[model samples]
Each structure stands twice: as structure tokens, then as C-alpha cells.
Target: MATLRIGIIMHGVTGRMGMNQHLIRSIVEIRKQGGVTLANGDRLLPDPILVGRNAERIAALARQYGIERWSVDLDKALANPDDTVFFDAATTQARPALLKRAVQAGKHIYCEKPVATNLAEALDLYRAARAAGVKHGVVQDKLWLPGLRKLQLLNDAGFFGQVLSVRGEFGYWVFEGDLQPTQRPSWNYRSEDGGGIILDMLCHWRYVLDNVFGKVRSVSCLGATHIPQRWDEQGKPYRATADDAAYATFELENGVIVQLNSSWCVRVRRDDLVTFQVDGTHGSAVAGLTDCWTQSRVNTPKPVWNPDVRQTHDFFDDWVKVPDTTVYDNAFKVQWELFLRHVAGEGEFRWNLLEGAKGVQLVELGLQSWKERRWLDVPELTGREGA
Candidate 1:
């Protein structure tokens, strides 16, 4: 079997997500599985060079993964013609410039989402990638998630007949770094560092809503900085300027209403860290990160409301668990495989940079909706809106 070697320059992967998801789980696992098989029966293998500003951290990450190449010089790495793909998981503000440079070097582009901190910058990256005439993609990994995939399958099979609405609950209480060490990075709670749940998570919800249910038509959002103070990496306390929580309502073009509550401050009493409950006339399904439970019209339990009396029904027991029918891989890894195949001239990749820009556009509207306390519309983008 002939294998096509594809060189990739992976930047900022020394960080948490870049290390765990993209590098270790995705690329490393891809190597172990003998690369992604193309439609024409050829296998595509990634030879990635880890790049970052911190020499020690980057080198250690590379060594831990048994990767040979590691570099602190991004420019030098980008200039290498052998490395045809450029992937970045860097800071939001630093992403546009880095992507612009890489595309100019004639490399195919792939990176983590939010693409930029704003819509204009996000559009600019799309424009640059298009102008460079190289293939481009973004990390919309949630689209391939096992739970979401199961939901998609149900949707495809018309299980949720006449879909009505959706509810998404996502978050967990993050320790304020004093009583217990914070699980999230300190920068996550700082607005100055390109942080905030709205900016970070609205991007995720945008894609998930648009792809799974329907295109988001508009948004109404309320944001809050629940805990005003949090300790940083060095155990130093600082005022948190960014929002930790957001209660958002979305209207889909298809008339499906969606309510999503995202917060780092709230405790998770739900099924998973993130769960989507899709309700329909004929049936309803609640999907977590891995498993999905469904209550069909035939099996759904009816309840009576009486405030004075104790509840008689067990709501949790009403739904039937959807059995796993297929083996599921890491979501990020799945997206990476599709991107690799797309680069190898296999098929069309719908999750392009422009799709990523749409995610940023939603963030802008969501933040504006919060500030104004009113619903704001999401306009369709064609990547030619005078960026």
C-alpha cells in the first residue's frame, strides 16, 4: 500500500487543547492507525512539526509524543515548502496574522475556531485564504461528536418529526483558584486575553445550531461575570473582567427556537458537561457528549401539574437509551481526517474558513444582543462583504 506523506506545522499545540486534542488524540492516533485512507485507496500520513514560543514546553511536548521535529521559529517553519499544511491553536488575537502568513506561503490552512476575536478579522482570514487559493478548514469538532452524530442520524431518519425546539446546558463550576486550584487557565476569565464564554462558546453553539438544527436567524443574550475575582497561575488574585456565564436564546431560520445556558460558574446537575435536548412533535432526544436518550411519541410519559402535591412521575425513567451502533473516534481526530482527505483531493469540505467566520459573526451578534438586551439578527455571509 502506497502512503502519501503530508507535512504539517502544528503551532501553539504546547498549550492544553492543542496538546491533548489536536496532537496526542488526533495526529498521534492517526499515525497509530496508519493514516487516513483516501477514496482512491491511498493512505495519507501526517508528519507534523510542533511549533511554539516556549522552547522548553514545545520540545517536551514533541518528545513526549515521540515526534522528531520541534521549532520555536514559526517563520522558518512556515517557509518550509515540504510542510504543506499549517495548523494553529494559538491565541485568538494572534491567529489572523499567523494564518495570513502561512497561506501566503502557499500552505493549506487548518486551525481552531473563533478564527478571530471579531467578525471583520475572521472575514479577513477567509479572504486571505481564498486569495491565496489554498484549501482551508476550521475546527468545528463538535459537529462530529458522537452524541451530535447520533442526533444527526436520528434527524436523518426522521425520528424527531416536526422538530420544535432545542435546549443546551453546558458548564461546570470552576474553582476560584484559592480554595482549590482552578481547572481552567487564568486567561479564560480575562477579557484582555481574548477570553469570555460568549466569545469562546457562542462560536461553538453557532455551528452546532446551524448544522444540527437550522441556521441561526437571530439571538438574545444576557452575560455575567459571576465571580468577580479569581487567582491566576501564580496564585495571585485578580479582578475578572470577562463574562463567565451567558443565557442565550436563538431563533433558527427553520422556526426552531433554541435556548442555551453556558457558564463556568454554574454547577453541572445535568447528564454531561454539555447536553442538547431536542424536542419535536413526534419524539424528543437528549444528547450528551457521548450518549443519547430518546422519548418517542409512543413512549413519552404524560405528567400532571399540581403545586401542592408531591410529584408521582419519575421523569428520568421515561426516556429510552439509544444504543451505540458504531465505534466513535475522537471528534477532533475525525475532523482532521476529513481535512487531510480534502487536501488530498478526495471530497468537498463544507466546514471551511468562511463557515468559521460565521461562528465569529454569531459571537458579535450575541455580545451585542447582551449589551442592548434585545434580539439581533444574523446576516448571511458570502466572504465578499468588503472586509
Candidate 2:
């Protein structure tokens, strides 16, 4: 059997997302499953070189993963003939240059979103990859989320007729690390680190809206930095310059409205870290990452406000929980398998750099809306002409 050995330059593999999601959950899990079996009876296995600046961390991760190849120098890895793909999970500020170099090096590209901190850099990355004739993709993990899939199915089945609006509530209190250590890195609270709820989450919202609701036409956003100060890993105090919370309203092309509230300083008492309640003329549905509850107008009872008498209605009981029929793995892993299939010429990769650019575009308009204190129009990306 001929081996289709694919080498990946995995930058920022030491970080949380890199360590947990990319390395442990996706790639390691894939390998443990005996790799992806092709229809031709061939197997596709990734030979990823863990790349980072810290030697001790790299060594520790290498030992943890049982992988031999590791590198501190990115240039050397990028120059390697064996490395066919460059995967970036680095900070947003570092992604543009890294992606440009990778494209110029003639490697396939896959990275976490928003691709870049701004639209121009994100657009440039797409154009460069296109010009270099290399396959490019971005992580749109939410599209593959299990609970959301059921919501999509319900929408497709017309369980929610003439969709009216969507409300997304996502957040959990991030410890200041003064008394309790923060779960996320301190960089996530600094603007210089490309850390803001609006930039980070609106990218996800764009894909969700495009995939589930409708194409977003305009947005009005309000951003806030509720947690003004925080402590780093070492107990050093730093001001939280980036926004920890964002309240945004988007108007879709289909005239359906979306109200999203994202926060890192709020308490979580909901079903999941993220909950989306989508309402239509006929019914409503609420979905988290793993569970979905829905109710149609047929099952909904009409009610009127009465101050004289006690109301008799079982609102929460009216909604029915949607059973999970399809098995689900990690959201990003599902996308990864699809991307691998796409790269192998077995299927199409719809979530390309252009789709990533749309995400960047939405974030840009959202920032604009926040700054200008007015609704802003979202312009189409260069590659979204026919889309």
C-alpha cells in the first residue's frame, strides 16, 4: 500500500485551542481511529510537526502525544519538502504573515477564524491562496455542532414557519485570576492581542446566520468591557482593554432579525455555554451545542394577559426535546474530516477562505457599528460574487 504522507506545520500547538481542540481532540483522535479510510482502501494519516517557540512546552507536548517530530523554528518547518499543509492556531495578529508565508511556500492552508483581525488582511490571505493555486480552508466549527444540526433539520422541515427572529445568549464568568485563576489566557482580555467578544464571536455568528437563518445585510452593535481588570497566570495585574461583552442586532436579507448577546463576565444558568432561541411565525426552537427544544404553533396554546386571575399555562412543558439520532464527534473534527476528503478530491470544500473572508467582513462591520453608534452595511467579499 502506497502511503499518502501529509505533513502539517502546526503552529501554536502549545496553546489551549491548539493543544485541546486541534491536537488532542481532532488529530490524535483521528489517528486512534486508525486514520481515515479512503474508499479505495487507502488510509490518510497526518504527520504533524508541532511548532512553537518554547522548547520545554514542545518537548512536553511531544512526549504527551507520542509524536517524534517537533520544531522551534517555523521557517525551517515551512521549508521542509515533507510539510504539505500549514495549519495556524496562532494569535489573530500573527496569522496574516504566517498564512502569506505558507501560501508562498506552496502549502495547503487551514486555520482558525476570524482568519485575520481585519477584513483587508483576511481578503489578502484568500487572494494569495487563490493565486498560488493552493487549497485553503477556515474553521467554521459551529456549522457542525450537533444540537444546531437538529435545529437546521427542524428549519428545513418547516417546523418553524416564516422565521421571525433569533436570540443568542452566550457567556460565563471568567475569573479575574486575583482570587481564582482565569481559565483563558490573559491575552484574551487585551485589545493588542486581538481579544474582543465582538471580533471573536461575531465571526461564528456570521456563519450561523448564513447557514441557518439568512445572509446578514446590516448590523448594529454595542461593546462593553465589564471586567475592567484581571490577573495573569503569574498573578500580575493588568487592565482589560478588550471588550468582554457585546450586544449586537443584525438584519438579515430575508428580513429576519438576530439579536446576539455575548459575554465573558456573566453567569451561566442556561442549558449550555451558548443558547440560541429562534422564533418563527409558526413556532420557536431553542438550541445549545448538544440539546434542542422546539414547539410549533399547533402545540402552542393561545393566551391573554389577565391581571384579575392567575394565568394557567405550562410554557416550559410545552416545548419538546428533540432526540439525537445522528452521532456527533468534536465539531471541528467533523469539519477536519470533511476538509481531508475535500483535499483528497473526494468531495467539495464549501467553507473556503472566501467563506472565511465573509466572517472577517461581518466582524469589521460589527466593529464599525459599535464605534459609529449606528447600523452599518456589510459589504460582500470579493469571492462572494456568485455566492
Work out the TM-score per prediction. Answer: 0.98, 0.96
Q: What is the C-alpha lDDT of each candidate?
A: 0.93, 0.89
TM-score of model 1 (CA atoms): 0.98
Give the per-residue lDDT of model 1 (tens digit) for 83-171: 99999998988999999999989999999988999989899889988888999999999998899999999999999999999999999
Residue-level lDDT tens digits of model 2 in 21-96: 9989998888778677777878788788999999999988988998779989989999998889899998989999
| Model 1 worst lDDT run, 10 consecutive residues | 297-306
After superposing candidate 1 on the true structure, give the runs of residues whose Cα lies further than 4 Å from its correct spot.
none
Model 2 ranges off by over 4 Å: 1-3, 306-314, 384-387
Give me the candidate number with maximum TM-score. 1
Clashes of 2: 0
